[model samples]
Target: MSRRRVGLTGNEAVALAWKQIRPHVVAAYPITPATQIVERFSEYVAQGEVDTEFVAAESEHSALSACVGAAAAGARVLTATASQGLALMHEVLYIASGLRLPIVMNVANRALSAPINIHGDHSDTMGSRDAGWVQIYARSVQDAYDRTLLAVWVAERARLPVMVCLDGFTLTHSLEPLEVYPDEAVQTFLGEAPTDGYTLLGGEPITVGPLALPDSYMEFRRALAAAMERVPQVLEEGVRAFRAHFGQDLPSLVDARGTEDAEVALVVLGSYADAVEQAALRARVRGQRAGFVRVVTFRPFPTTPLREALGGVREVVVLERADTLSGLGGPLGVEVRAALYDLEVRPRFTDVIFGLGGRELRDEELDNLLRAGPPGGVVYLGVEGSRVLELA
Candidate 1:
């Protein structure tokens, strides 16, 4: 249970935690921000520090394909990617989850390109929102490291793949202090590598990824959907077991701060959480009752806490780094609104899409927003065409 402070970037933290867990296979390719994770892990493989099968895949698609294959063969598998790299792996992402492979992937969240710029954003992960993976975001380097370990525990238990995501350059490259668990404690937390007779490595022969004809295709899809419904429960059990071993509890999937008695709440996610939380505190200094809600587990959507976080607030300001152009608001905003759609006593919602493609948010942006009170609909931050686009 001894913990010591160590300095590490998000990518290094993921690589370090993953190395400790020692997955059976790692399928990797070099992608910005995310590359450091696989590259650092590769050093361990070369140095004989880890007994992992390192697959130097040709492309992101090949990387995930290799993970699917390894995991299908009952290997604890892992991989890392971001941005278009994730886009390239899009097809196989579904297959990994469809076949019920418990592969743990680290996505250094980045902006998907048409303009060909590479930096941090949630566009990559947001695009795959329905890819049937349990997506969880980390707010800092320590969270990135801890969450990476937790993802493995959760994925193996649920037999569902998990994506531990971090902001591309912001967190991925920024070094910070974090406490790492001792190796023995980590093993105790994870328990034995799970093998519940649903793999190719088992004695009984089994086939995976068979093409389902029309009669069974719908049923297969339903099974996957139903499996996702079990994620919240799996997450609950996983966190409980983790807390019992570590003596420190992981916060629930969604975290609420200053919300117990507040008229305004800010809903946000990812690496910018600290800033948003500070914005909430600053609001309090000005005699405004402000609070903030952060999404930790993005998939299965954490509906319960999200609804409770905004329960009695009179207005909500949702700050998202990624925007959904086709929708009424940003991705997180749309989801937050959907979570409380049927509830009668819900706060008014405002969606603000900011900091896309590593865009620099103005120094006073958060302070100004807190001072101005919650606006209505989609507000694009720091753009030249500056105008509030009303929700459609």
Candidate 2:
């Protein structure tokens, strides 16, 4: 297996990975932050670098619809979008997953509109969290590239749509050095596109996406839930294969650091976790038992791994970019708290909300926050006006 080190933005890295995968179809609508991914992949299509049908759909909905159709027809399929574009695909997001189509999508995570901000945040993907897709977040250009490829494998094996999310401009536009594996190595690792599932092109009479009556609808939903439960096993299998073939150690679904014996831990997702980790490291050098965990896989929510990581910690701070708007902290805070609720010696947890609409989490600010320890409830950091919102 050969490898080359190269400089690329997160979007370019993802596009290059797709080129190597050479899926049968890519249907997408260009959107800010995420547009460059499809733009670069389209160039690959035009230059004949890969034999793929590129469909420039009129809207994000149409783009994902095309991908759903192609995937249902037994073609390997993918697409890219962000913010409003991803919101537009919300309805079809469930359709793809309900039909169990192995469609993979890349989302340059961006803030949703109301005041029309186009910056990076987890709001877009977290908004569509219940749409039944395998959600994976990346912290760097290399993570974006490797995880996009990993998402494809997980999607196919789990028979569910996978969303590979990277921070909008933060990761998508920032340049970084990454290792590129040989095409044959990647191809050999992924093997062939799955063909055992139901397909429209199978040349047999079959009912696809039929309306299930009230009696059977519950069963269908239960089956989808069961499929999600089985994904951790399938995802772990792919990670092992990828490690063996590419000699690259990808982060586990729950990427924990310094938490094995640390007394304080911060739980976060996407690139923001990198900042928290750096601060935690400094705190450790200063004799503070501080640690942080980056959640790589958000969907199916890695409850078991998280429990193991935070089980013995004395205090936990969950910092999230998007608010749950429930006056109960953020989406991740709610989930993490629930995940650790049953622990025998539960940590004193606090929810720190920050980085909404691409707000930067500065190192000094994070350093200050880490030194303060857990506040024992919900606190708003870096936001003006109201600083702390105490939850009853």
Candidate 3:
């Protein structure tokens, strides 16, 4: 398949991929970093390049509510938001998943504001981790494009909503070169949303978002969990299909490098993983066996793959993009430790919480992490105060 190569920011790449998917409905509100995704996609809607219903909702809550209605109505739905905008959509997020509506949303990860920082961070998506959604993190603009297209298939198969998360300014605003498959290839790969799932549209009238009372509440929620349990395999199949169709090789869950006999390892995500990997390579040249793992899937939390990936390392440092505010560790830190808890021999763990609200980690900063070994406990990087968090 001949592909078109173009330079695009993550937001623009998402817009391009969503255009190729050509969803039936898009109800979105503007928020920093994420706003451009819908903005450019709306342009395609206006130009009649795609026949999509573009609804400019009043707020993020209304945006997702509209998505739930559309998805329930059996329309292929899409939306985008970041930070506080996502916080506003908190309630409807689970409702979309609980009702088994496969709504695909693009989240440009950003920090929640008190002092009003409009920068990239995982706080938004991390906070919504338990909302019954499949979260896929992108490592580059190419991934932002590829994952957005693949997410439609994964979400429909999982019978749950999916969030395609990309770094706000890091990838969302920076342009990079990537190949987009021919429109026919994309169409064939996506195929069509399956109709076997429960629906509130077309077929017999079905009561959705029903009052489960006590008797069926757990069952309903359990059904959603059961659906999520099937996502990892479904996603793997989707990746295989995508590879066969587009000849693009992609790791479905976790991307691990140099883990074999690795003495030191760093776990990171999004674009930051690139920097960490480079630092690991540098350490390798200096006679240290270092590696890094990127957790691509966040929601279903691929514990099995992560555990196996970290198992071989003697020392592991979990680099968290968002603070858990627990005074102990960040979200990813807790997850890593929990994943490796039962392993017979696990890597020594250290949590470094940094890069909130778009703090950039220089190559040297990451290099020092491996060279210096574990910091013993939670270390707050890039903070000048040097007082809030103490390294044990």
Candidate 4:
């Protein structure tokens, strides 16, 4: 299929892809960054472009709860939210995954509120990391569109919920030209949903919501963990299929740039990696063997792949947009340290927590930060009066 370039915001790209997927049900509440996704989907339903049920949910929690009900009935379901809306739906988020409902969601990654910021950050999704959902991050509008289609396929195949995240405001509201594949391409790539005996029927009664007893609870939890464990293989297959049909190869876990024989590596997730990649390139041009790794998949954590990528490095810096306040560790930093725990020759590592609440991360700043590194300890970029620690 021929792909045509269309200028679209990240949210619009996601909405367009969801339309092609033709979900049976969509329940969403309007929220910053994520509002446009449902708005566009609702328009498609209204225009008869999609023959689907569109439910305008009263609240974010209700929206996710409605999607869970629809998905439990074996309907392909979708929803979107940002920041506190995502937090509000936190309870059902875990339930959706625990029940193995396969709901695909677009999370316009935004900062969680205290004083309240409607802009982009990883805090919202980071807050829900324990919700048992597969999380995928996109760096561009095109990736945002492509990943949404893949998320549905991945979720249903793994029988797990998937969140395709784009940095709110930064990517969500940023306009970019997207190469949208035809509907036939998407259908060909994703194939059809499984016709299992899971759907809710008019007269046929089947028990979906059941009380779990202590006798079977542990077994059920183990099965869910097993399903998540199988996700990497399913995701790789889906990416291959998607590339065959759409001519775009999606990275399932991480994208490595100039890592061969590198002594230092900078690691980041989501859109910020784009900046880091450019910085790495500039560093490389100056005869420094610096490299960058962009993590695309966050949940199930991608430990093995990351450890393999960082094994040869002498120094590493982890750039995180989300913080684990209680632990005094950035989310990505903690995960990176955990991945390197058993390695015999671990690199000097630094945790750089920056770009929170939609603050911009400059390429020059990243280059300078990486250059002046023992690469140990925490540094907060863009924060006033922040001290940079040089660990011995």
Using all chains and alpha carbons, the TM-scores for the candidates as numbered come to 0.96, 0.97, 0.97, 0.97
How would you encode candidate 2's per-residue C-alpha lDDT over 1-392 as one tens digit per residue?
67899999999999999999989999999999999999999999999999999999999999999998899899999899999999999999999999999999999999998879999988899999999999999989999999988988899989999999999999999999999999998889888998975688886867779989998999999999999999989989989988998998987588998999898998989988778888889999989998789999999899999999999999999988888889888899999999999999999988988887888877766777766556778887777663342111
lDDT of 1 by residue, 104-172 (tens): 999999998888878888999998889999999999998888888889999988889999999988999
For all candidates in order, the CA lDDT equals 0.88, 0.90, 0.88, 0.88
Residue 349 Cα positional deviation in candidate 2, in Å, after optimal superposition? 1.4
Clashing pairs in 4: none
Q: Model 4 residue 391 lDDT?
A: 18
For every candidate structure, what is the RMSD over all alpha carbons to the true structure, in angstroms?
Answer: 2.4, 2.2, 1.9, 1.9
Could you say which candidate leads in lDDT?
A: 2
lDDT of candidate 4 over 1-392, digit per residue (tens): 78888899999999899899988899999999899999988999999999989999899999999999999888889999999999999999989999998999999999988869988889999998878999999989988998999998899999999999999988899999999999888887777777487567535787775788999888988998899889999999989988888889888988887777888898999988778888888888877889889999999789988989998899888898999995556988988999998999998888888888888877666766766753478778767665542210
What is the Å distance of residue 231 in model 4 from its true position? 0.5
Reference-based lDDT, residue 170, model 2: 92
What local lDDT does model 4 show for residue 141?
90
Error of 3 at 69 (Å): 0.4
* lDDT (tens digit, per residue) of candidate 3 on 1-392: 89999989899999999999989999999999898999999999889999999999999999999999999888899999999999999999889888888899999999898878989989999989999999999999999899998999998888889999999999999999989888888899988877764677666888778788999899888878888888899999999999999898888889999997798888997889888888889999999998889899988989999988888778888887898888768998888889998989977888988898888776766766666667768888767764322221
Q: Which parts of model 3 are misplaced by more than 4 Å? A: 387-392
Error of 3 at 106 (Å): 0.4
Q: What is candidate 1's TM-score against the reference?
A: 0.96
